[model samples]
Target: MNKIQQFWSDFCIVTHKEGIEYKDAFQFGTSADWLADLVVEGKKTATTSGYMFYEFENEAIPQTGEYYIVLNGLEEPVAVIQIQSVEVIPMNEVTEEFALAEGEGDYQFWWNAHEKFFTELLKEYDKEFSPNMLVVCERFKKVYSK
Candidate 1:
């Protein structure tokens, strides 16, 4: 296993001893480390993506009660987070409350950032961007960080 996988394993053992269970591991953002730090600092409690579930049917949606190992840009496990809730809304319908929960910035800032992100992301599938596209919004709580 790699350092991250090993760290995740060790983390699981530690949490298991504390009666907490973790489900999977993943990283945030594409090329930056900021999001991981935000999560570790308890500043960011939510995230959203336009990656459609039907397009990637094998990937499981973030479900409430599941824990995830958050990895930084270096792929090192930085923290563990327990999913609190999840919802799907159109890109244009994301509420300011949810945007604030992202802890990135104001609603317009959140919208602009996500717009650029999803626009580039859709290119992977040769797809085009749409303001009405569905986005999966997830809220989570920090459980542990290393």
Candidate 2:
């Protein structure tokens, strides 16, 4: 089996969730190594992404109670997370507390970083970033890690 499959199998076995048949593994924006490190250290607990990206890719919006395996830049599974909450709101509407949960820095840092990231990502698709654009805000708990 590939590394992600093996990691998922082992995680299920240890967590007593073998009956679950769904597995969604992904890395954080651009890559996953730095974000994975933050997560492993319990510094990062939440993230936000532009809703247009999901619609552009024809992917379903993230929902609460879903579980996902967090992969690193090398594509190795490093952590498992369970979604605790989900909110779809305007990018400019995010609360300071939620931004802080991202563990990147303070509210201003989060705002500046996200604005820039979204702007660049949208550009690649010939789209434009707007402060009023919808963003999927997710809060998750680290359930298991290796």
Q: In terms of TM-score, which candidate is strongest?
A: 2
TM-score of every model versus the real structure: 0.86, 0.95
Model 2 C-alpha lDDT versus the unseen true structure: 0.90
Runs in model 2 with CA error above 4 Å?
Answer: none
Measured with C-alpha atoms, the lDDT of residue 57 in candidate 2 is: 93
Each prediction's whole-model lDDT (CA) = 0.83, 0.90
- At residue 109, candidate 1 shows an lDDT of 91
Q: Distance from true position, residue 145, model 1, in Å? A: 0.7
Q: Candidate 1: deviation at residue 51, Å?
A: 4.1
Q: What is candidate 2's CA lDDT for residue 91?
A: 93
* Candidate 2, residue 33: how far the Cα is off, in Å: 1.2
Model 1 Cα lDDT, one tens digit per residue, 1-146: 98766766777777674455567777877744788889989999999977584465667777898888888887778888889998888989989999999988999999988889888978887888899999989999997787
lDDT of 2 by residue, 25-55 (tens): 9898864799999888999999999998899
